[model samples]
Target: MRIKRLVQKHPEEKTFWKNDQWFNVYVQVNEEKRPDYKSRLYGEFDRFGFEAEDKYASLAEDDEHNGWRLFRRFKMVLHNNKRLTKDVTVKDFCGKQMTAFPLFVMSIKYLREHLLQAVTTQKIGIEETDILYVLTVPAIWDDNAKRFMRDAAVDADIDPARLKLALEPECASIWCETLGTDVKGAVAIAGSQYMVVDLGGGTADVSVHERKPDGSLKEIMKASGGPWGGIFVDENYMKLLDRLYGEEALTDLRKTEMSDYFDIIREFEHKKRTVDIKNTKHVIVRLSVSLRDLANKYSKQSLEERIAALDSHKNAITPKGKDKLKVDWTVIQSWFKIPIDLLIQHIKTLLAEPKMKRVQTVILVGGFGESQYVQDRIRKEIPDDLKYTYGTNVFQYFDENKYPDDKKVWENGKWQVPFCFKVYVRVNEQVKVDQQMTKRSTPNSKISLTAVYRTTQEHPKYITDPGCELLGTIELENSTDIPFEQQRLETTFMFGDTELFVKTKNKTTGKEAYMTFECFT
Candidate 1:
């Protein structure tokens, strides 16, 4: 009936889909503690969510030597490397190797099993069949990446029929619109148009939605945004530390005193949230003695000495007492600048579009969206007017002037419209999963079918047109006993999938054959 928000301790680590509607996931890949911090598909590790993040960060040094790696952000697994197809095969901590697919399977299985157990225990009073599981994914993720998640979910034993995929920002818009009427800024009413910006740890996703008169929401703009999220701010913090302590010292800290290393970032994360335009006071962050001692050991200088020796940040950063650092509000705000600027730039671009002219409200959701600085920056830069597709299969935004009007069939009274098939479809623009059209043609005893062309091209409207290439063919056989006109060759064209299917049958003989052609994205 309604989405139930399951409160969790780690709000920052919670994935968008976990708002309890549908869920989406990303994984951290494990492997060599490479200096580059890029992820790799790993074996023998299944720690998930924020817990996975902490585990991966904690095991940074341990995994390099032992080969045991923990990972997160698995949802973007396909985005990082162009060559990786499905699950990648790599060695685990124990030196035993397997595909990353199993790790995802194991994680989803944990959730699926937990939910089923809850149902069995009466925690949830509903039939197993009544449950519809949704997996949320980024609008930027390619079809392969989305499919990779789908396959993982299917392998996890979540029934495919009950599973659906949602775009991160789109669903956030849905959640915002569905908020109770008593809530402030509640605009779920019909004709309300709003822009939803979902700023997660890895990326800032943007989308626009309008509530239709029928109580359903329609997207007015495609999803767009970039890697301007909380993690980048964290990276900026790390970079600052790298400058102060030197790379060697920070590496040593991560390897030797990992918890202290995590503590430093955690403290900064807290500071990042609290420091804003109104809070002009210097923020205090406690420094572990190990970090101070390590700084001395690695750089032959204490952190205090390093802070005093700084060039530009010299006055802004201060070594307070012995075990703490006092940072000027300006210095702290710089860490948020890059991400906020990037996010604002994107939001501005989306709002500037003519099609987005009617959108009046902007909804903010996601962990990074909690930042007062981020919120302020958006309001300051864009002033008013704020923004902002589907999970991939690379979609090209065709210019309105470039293509002919959408597919239409002249039928009874106004086009008996868009009752076609598809997971997502636009009004006046229908894409069927498998719409079959039957045409009857009289033929003799046999009909020769010569061609099956696999072309990515969508136009030309005929087989004789350019862009068609020969693939394979099949012939249909008929019974000679049937009347000439009655010996019908029934041809059916199915346009439900990425590939086009043609099914043929001989009316008199009951003989059948089919051919498939790949559709160009």
Candidate 2:
């Protein structure tokens, strides 16, 4: 209902996924009130978790506050894999069999409930029918993947007619259109070609577009991307830690201190965004007590001893405090290398293509696009002539053209004949001529007329209907004010279920003539 009220208040605004993260839902709001629609609700994808039947059953007995295990990163995996069909079941953390389709449906339902609750709390007035949903998918997703998403939405009660699919980069391009000249400046100029780099949490999508004179975009090349994203960076970091602490120790820490592990990753995300590989001397990451103890036990060395042994020309890692560790620039750079290298390679491949040769600017957007290291790597690796800009939000550029209403405008009316016609005449001192034409038709019959003109020379003047589908011409014997020999007029007519008439008048003599025609199907 809130979605409906929002639609009623601002019909142009539609609901959309903020990004591939799937952690938040962004609803477009009226631009007059808030230029940026930061309005978001929590996504329910991670809310449902698997637990032992006995534990879940006992928890269900309470009917509230039941513990649910959290499932994360599965959305990306499911979307990327072709073998994971709607009917295939996956094991959750608790080893419960859950179909991927229902998980998506549950997520959609959670989103809908949150939207409705927001509307109710805000006291907006409307109904379910007024809301339209737009889902954004990676441009690289094939038709089957897109269809699966649509089917999930439909199974969740989203109307098929009201649902729309959009490409992530194109959505970012639309948002770029809303940027002010003071911000985007000449890059927003019409006819400029831009490569939209959507570096989100799970993937880095790239697309090229040329801005049209009308402010719309023409896609110059197909979109391309890979699994290299912020998540991969996090995974690489985790792998590094696993190597240093031993896989068993890290696994134990994850099982025993899941919250602390999440916090550690979250801190890495912040550092990943702010870390300056060019100037920063060192980067510090917080470590939990359990993790530190486990690492020391598995490696048979004190945390400080390990740091001293691993120190090298590139950089060094040392214990910052009881709960933190300092990593030198070299170590941090190595962690960023995996994803950043992939990203740079992707951009190079795109730029090397003949179609992308003329593209001078690259517009970076999405979560990972906000990384300074990523941006710096691009600047260093890309051609000097190429330009790139970064922004956190660019969804406003996504436009959805919905289907038009099918209502008719005119009412049935009785058949009534209107008389109208056209005529042509020529006058000279020696001769005068006049022509008139008319058509007779029945209700069930069709009529067509054709006329030909013959002359010694071609006619310079001709007339045609508004659609230019029918024409008439007049010819004379010679190019003279007064015809010396013969004059002819030719006309052609084709009629269908409508009636038509033409009228012509002689301005000098104030004489008028008429012609009529009809058609039936």
Candidate 3:
């Protein structure tokens, strides 16, 4: 298939609406009703949208959280711990809490319920298994992370067979397929290659794709990204607050009026994105009255005096009328500098690769991608090789072609299914990458089930043998409504990279379905 499958995800907004109205994912659990964030009691959760995300600080400091601690950025376990087993219990950063898993389950359930509710409201009947629930994750996430996400979906009452984990950057680019090549100085169209930089809240996923002659985009370079996201800017802004507000006062406010504290931060959040590269005027932000009062109570100094005490060349933060603070453009720019620098550096290295050389348009997509400051910095800092205007003009979308380089070896179209089922890798098997991915193709009258197994004994004959254990199943259904002769399944088992990507296309319908298989080695 020339183009990858077009699964979907969020665009460059708090929640970009796919079908008319936006379905928000920022879930705010009613901590008042349930003190436990890890409660498995699904469908009882509250709103999860921008308002909930903005209220995260407040939720973290609720009175009920006195004994337990709140954890953020809990997704890093997959990357940090390479020895992590699928069944191993995941703990918090301090290795104490078992809360992240259940939290994930709750979030997934809430999302599913909301989606179902939206459909039901329109008087539409949808089967749970027939509807493939797509969950987009950072491309930097490895196999373990993918497994964790899949397990969470399973726990959320979703069938793993119907679940599809879409890479975040690919989701962004695939969503842009309809962004026709009508823009000025356009290079992205049918057959041209481009790069997708998905800058989300905490991670930036980068990938390159080429539009095939059949209108399907093929992945040239797999996923490469880092933790250089927009949240880093928010962190720097917090550091600035700690320095200016006095850590004691800030800490006290976080303990007492966290909602106000979050609002204070969100005030800067709103202002930061608006400040552009050419912005020369001071960005004005309305300060929370509680913050200003607490600053004086704890610091024993007024806001004006604190500004005066700074030894810098110019005052980055200035006191405006009563509660408003006029922040310098320089300060906002500095907050954006480090993360954007790291992100651009990563892009430069990605572009330097042989396969990546043909990439012309660098489409920036995500919530962070909406930042005028981030976009402006990318335009100025990155090399001229990325000349096309990102996020503004070039947004292409389509089905994502993952593991595009996995070549399928078909032998004379004679017999592949019968042999594939009987194929075996000896215990302590030592075979090349090419051998593992090779499989023959033939039309089947019925669906085929390719079961993967792991055995303890060196020579185990059947799955019912003493040491053999069923690990996973890869199923191939007819690609489209077609005759047995018109169907062809391009099956491949890619190992060593830690997963299996199976591609099948119906010759008559020209439809393709991707199946990913994950199992214990």
Please name the candidate that would achieve the greatest lDDT relative to the true structure. 1
lDDT of each residue in 1-521, candidate 1, tens digit only: 00112223243423343211222233323323431211222223345555654665556546533333443344444556566665475443223334566666667777887788988897656777888998888776667778888988998878899999998998887676457563225456687778888988887888888888897878888787777778878887787777777888777876777668767877887777766557467888876777777777778776767778777788888877656878787876887888888788788888778887666667788988888878766655553421100000111233345423463434433332222221111112233345455656566344535344433343323333454445556676667666656776766656532455777787667789887765422
Weakest 10 consecutive residues of candidate 2 by summed lDDT: 386-395
* Candidate 2 global CA lDDT score: 0.56
For model 3, residues 390-501, the per-residue Cα lDDT tens digits are: 0000111211352122222333453111211223344334333223444445555556455565555554433554645555555556643556765565545544223445
Instruction: Report the C-alpha lDDT of model 2 over 1-521, residue by residue, as the tens digit.
Output: 00101212345544443322122222445344542221222223333322222333343345521224334555675557776577655555434344466566666766777787887788777677788888888876777778888998897779999899988988887787678663264346787787888988888788898878887778899888877778877887787676556787777765556556656877888898987766888888887888888887777776555545553521376666678877777777776788788888888888778887667667788988888878867755664331111001001111123212231122223222221122221111111012123332211111122322211112212222121123232221222343322322223232211222344333322333434433110
Question: lDDT of each model, Cα atoms only?
Answer: 0.62, 0.56, 0.60
Error of 2 at 75 (Å): 1.9
TM-score of 3: 0.60
List RMSD in Å for every model shown. Answer: 26.5, 28.1, 25.5
- Clashing residue pairs in all predictions, respectively, total 18, 8, 16
Cα TM-score per model: 0.60, 0.58, 0.60
- Quality of model 1 by C-alpha lDDT: 0.62
Model 2, stretches more than 4 Å misplaced? Answer: 1-67, 88-97, 119-123, 180-188, 296-300, 304-315, 384-521
